[model samples]
Target: MQLGLSNKDQKKVLTAFYSLGEVCGTIWDNIV
Candidate 1:
């Protein structure tokens, strides 16, 4: 299934997810 986002948009989404994952990781590390 595709969301029909353009290449640039896809890149933005990927970057957003990457940063979000990093943020979550930092929070998890702090909690533990």
Candidate 2:
């Protein structure tokens, strides 16, 4: 499945998750 987000958008969302918690790394897809 393709994420409709641009690379920069993807990075920003992931960065937000990373800022929230360490588990975000493992469950990035499910959380968002």
Candidate 3:
């Protein structure tokens, strides 16, 4: 549902709603 979209969209939703370790590093990079 999310990974298909742009990295921005994926980060926006995941950072706010989810906390799966699989994506933590990716999201952290997105934020910083």
Q: What TM-scores do the predictions have?
A: 0.91, 0.56, 0.35
Best by lDDT: 1
Per-residue lDDT over 1-32 for candidate 3, one digit per residue giving the tens place of the 0 to 100 score: 53678889877877776556657878888999
Expressed as tens digits, the lDDT of each residue in 1-32 for candidate 1 is 46999999999999999999999999999999
Clashing pairs in 2: none
Better of 1 and 2 by TM-score: 1
Q: What are the lDDT scores of the predictions, listed in order?
A: 0.95, 0.81, 0.75
Query: Sorted by lDDT, highest first, which candidate order results?
Result: 1, 2, 3
Report the C-alpha lDDT of model 2 over 1-32, residue by residue, as the tens digit.
45899989999998988777866655887877
**Candidate 1 Cα misplacement greater than 4 A, ranges:** none
**Model 3 residue-pair collision total:** 0
Q: Clash totals for all models, in order? A: 0, 0, 0
- What is the alpha-carbon lDDT of model 3 when measured against the actual structure? 0.75
Q: At residue 6, what lDDT does model 3 achieve?
A: 88
By summed lDDT, which 10 consecutive residues of candidate 3 come out lowest?
14-23
Residue 19 lDDT in candidate 1: 100
